[model samples]
Target: MNDHIAPPTAAPAPALQPVRAAGIATMTALALAGLGWAARGVWQIRLAMAGEPASGPPDQGGGVHRPLTSLEDSYHLVTTVSGFAAAVCAIAFLVWTGRVRDNARELSGTRPRYSGLWVYFGWVVPVVNLWFPRGIIADAYRASAPGERLPRSLNVWWGLWLIGMLSGVGLMYGDNTDEIIARAYAHVWQLLASDAAVVGAAVAGIFVVRAVTAVQERHLDEP
Candidate 1:
């Protein structure tokens, strides 16, 4: 008479909820708009350097350079507004990134390589930021891919983002120069570089966000 009992079936892993990326999408749009504003500032500066009158409303008497004056005011306004928008975008991005990290951990059914908290700190901590965020993102992509090969979007986005951040730091240092003429010249080039990098990073970032979200959602739909 056999008295051995059948082993109970193991419970299935919890389903991974789809990650909401609306915040990320908004951040990407803001980044692109900021880049456009930066480009406009660069163009205005270039016009001044070329000794050409900025294109705008015509002067209405009193010999005042109304177009140039308007351009100057608009430049300052755009720069200020873009900077504020960028800060908001950064915060939104951080929140969305944390959500993605959580979803990746759930999909893989394994502990994340980095603690979830690192997702926020990793971007702000000086030297550690250079590679820490990249590592976390790579891990997320792999976890979401599971048996599939990870796409190149993650690496491209990371590289562009790092370059943009480094260029922005360089621009900050360049701004501290005491030579007004030299500083102005340096700023034109620096702004151009920074803006270009920002555009590239934003475009690449959109692809990475979409790819990761899709992969994780696919995993959740599977039996």
Candidate 2:
């Protein structure tokens, strides 16, 4: 009888996912969403310039508030539309990240540092949100591009995104439109700075997506 035991067979590695088309789609979605946010910022500046005035006294015991002016009403509409676009764009970005990550696995022959679920959750999960998304992208970059210097565009993008997210922009953020306009009235420079950072983040993010995707797409042609 044979005394030696045979070793267990390892599972087959996953096939690489195509990323070129996903990259194009993500870039287009992000561009539209970013432009929408910029437009909202412009409207906010217009509102600030016009002295975002309150309609009337605080609604004590359910008194009717005055209706919105055309400009203020218009700002509200821009905010709503931009917000919806942002939500859709976020989904597209996450999907692109997932594809690149799987391609990284095939290229590097190693598992990603973060799990697949983190691709979606990392952007929203409190402290983890701060780093996981960057880590995921960077790991893929290192694997796909190998010797290339990790570009500063990635760092710039993440930094601006953090600044925009933590202390600025978004209706879901604590400061409502009226309150933000009120604050902007008191501190116009602050509003300008916040909007600039948000828009800058969006622009830098485009370069980042393009750089990473281009490198990975090229790698697909390698022997």
Off by over 4 Å in 2: 1-14, 54-64, 169-172
Q: Per-residue CA lDDT of candidate 1, range 1-223, in tens? A: 3568777899777666556455456557656655764665475465447542334333333654343444445554665666666776677666667777787887678899899778888988999898888788678878877677666877887787787789767453344211222333444665566667776777777777677777777776777
Q: What's the lDDT for candidate 1?
A: 0.65
TM-score for candidate 1: 0.74
Q: Across residues 43-103, which tens digit of lDDT does each residue of candidate 2 receive? A: 7678668874655312212544456678767867887888887888788889999989888
lDDT of 1 at 134: 77
- Using TM-score as the measure, the top candidate is 2
Where is model 1 poorest over a 10-residue stretch in terms of lDDT?
176-185
lDDT of 1 at 150: 64
Cand. 2 TM to true fold: 0.85
Q: Give the C-alpha miss distance for residue 194 in model 1, angstroms.
A: 2.0
